[model samples]
Target: MPDLRLDTTDLERAATGLDAVARALAGTDTLAGDGAGDLGHDGAAAALRRFAESSTRRRDELGRAVEEFAGHLRECVSTFDGTERSLAEGLGGAA
Candidate 1:
C-alpha cells in the first residue's frame, strides 16, 4: 500500500492563498473608469460600461466562491486536527 499523508498545515496554507486571491478580486475597481463617458463616442463608452459591469459582477461572484471554499478548507483542517488529537489521546489513555 502506498503511504498517504494528509497535512492540515498545507491545507491551511492553501486556504490562506485563496483568501488572498479573494481579497485581491474584491479590491478591484471598475476597468472602464468613472470617466467612461469621456470616451468621445457614446456607443463605445456604453459598451465599455456594460463590459465593466459584467466583469465586476463576475469578479465579485468568483471572490465570494473562493472565500467560501477557503472557509470550507479551514473547517476541514479544524475537524481533522480535532479528530487526530482525540484519536491520539484515546490511544495514549489505552496504553
Candidate 2:
C-alpha cells in the first residue's frame, strides 16, 4: 500500500479554525432573550422564548462537540508528529 502522508500543519490549522467556531458558538447567549417583553404580545413572546431556549441549548451542545473534535484533531497531530520524529531518529541511529 502507498504511504499515507498527512500534513500536520494543515490539520493543526483546521483545529485552530474549529476552535474559533466553537468559541463563536459558545457566545450565543444573546439568543436567550433577557427582555422579551418588548415584543408586545404575551403568547408570541412566550413562544419565542421557548424557541430561543431550545436553539441556545442545541447550539451549546454543538459547540461542546466541536471543541471536543478539535481537541482530538490536535492530539492526532501531536501523535503523528512524535511518531515520525521517533522513527527518523531511530533510523539515523541505525545508520
Which candidate has the top score in TM-score? 1
- Could you tell me which residue pairs clash in candidate 1? none
lDDT of each residue in 5-91, candidate 1, tens digit only: 789899999999999999999998995756679899988888888888999999999999999999999999998888778878888
State how far residue 95 of model 2 sits from its true place (Å): 14
Best by lDDT: 1
Error of 2 at 41 (Å): 2.0
Per-model lDDT: 0.90, 0.87
In terms of lDDT, the poorest run of 10 residues in model 2 is 28-37
Q: What is the lDDT of residue 11 in candidate 1?
A: 100
Clashes of each: 0, 0
Against the true structure, candidate 1 reaches a TM-score of: 0.88
